[model samples]
Target: MLLETHVLQDTDPDLPALLADGFEVVGESWGAEFVIDGGAESTASLERLRGFVETARAAGLEIRELDARDAAAIESLDAESWVDVPTTPATVHVPVSALDVRDWATRGRRAFGALDGDRLVGLCVGAAGDNDFVVVAPDQRGRGIGGAVVAAWMLGAIEAGERSFSAGGALQNARSLAMIRAVGFRVTERWLSLQRP
Candidate 1:
């Protein structure tokens, strides 16, 4: 069962002893969202996102909008990014095949990527301006490329009159979680996949 974590927490009227008797949590995913709610991001938030893009530039990565053509180059990198994730049901990822990448690369008004010369080292994209995911190459993760890619995407998305953004990551993936939250995504859902022995 995919149960909201809060449903089993102290905030819930039902105690864990009453609700968790037979279910063992096998994995979890944090769902976050940042919506304009008929408005726009505050000025400070815009500055922070812009700063991430600049920081990525200082690290020698070129951040720019992506198109359908760049998909093949980064398909392998996208697949590789899922390697460290646990195979449990909740965290299972469908690697973005080259075709899948091509399909969504040009969607959502525009998507963005961080490139090291001719190589795509990180990408942030989704259909219709939703925050599907971001993946940075293993060697490039700590330098904020992932965050920059997403920030750049958000900048474009906001300018395009898009308002709603949503993203999710494994609860255990601190780096992924922090990157999204740093851009103002708030955790709205915490889903725990449970199994019966």
Candidate 2:
């Protein structure tokens, strides 16, 4: 059997009791959820992301807000991004379905896409009142596409009157953690997901 519990780190919950009850921390990480306060960001991360923006522009990559019409492209990017997630023995291949595409492309969902002459190369999908996920095409890595896309998305979100933002990912995902932190999301909580033996 598998069970999971999400609690605020500040609450000082009883972890020993859970362990004694045959529960083990299957996963735990720092800064799993980062809160983005309006457009406020760490000076360091801001500089980094901005640098990426300039670099991408020089490379002829354009960033823009996306709509329903770009859904298919976003879905394709999603599948490609998922397939490239650093895999391990614990990884699972969850197929992306049509429903998933529709959900990602739903109207009014605040999203952004990066284009190189009309070809979608990156995407930033925002969660309702939550942290958003960013994906850049495999060939697009190291070109600052991921960071630039995120920076643009955050600007758009701020303009839409969203004052708070948060993001979460696996503990081992350093690239994402750095990107989010660069956007000024401090580590507020570390969640311990427990499972039965």
Best by TM-score: 1
Which runs in model 1 stand beyond 4 Å of their true positions?
A: 1-21, 37-41, 105-110
lDDT of 1 at 78: 84
**lDDT of each candidate versus the true structure:** 0.76, 0.65
For residues 1-197, write the lDDT of model 1, one tens digit per residue: 65533223223444465446776676677778877664345666778889999999998889999777887866877887777754445556677777876666345335689989998899887655577777888887788898899999988888877777788767888888888888788898776655555
Using lDDT, give the best candidate's number. 1
Cα error, residue 69 of model 2, in Å, equals 1.6
Inter-residue clash pairs, candidate 2? 36-165, 131-166
Stretches of candidate 2 exceeding 4 Å from the true structure: 1-12, 29-52, 86-108, 127-129
What TM-score goes with each of the models? 0.83, 0.74
10 residues in a row with least lDDT, candidate 1: 4-13
Alpha-carbon RMSD to native, per candidate: 3.9, 4.3
Estimate the lDDT of model 2.
0.65
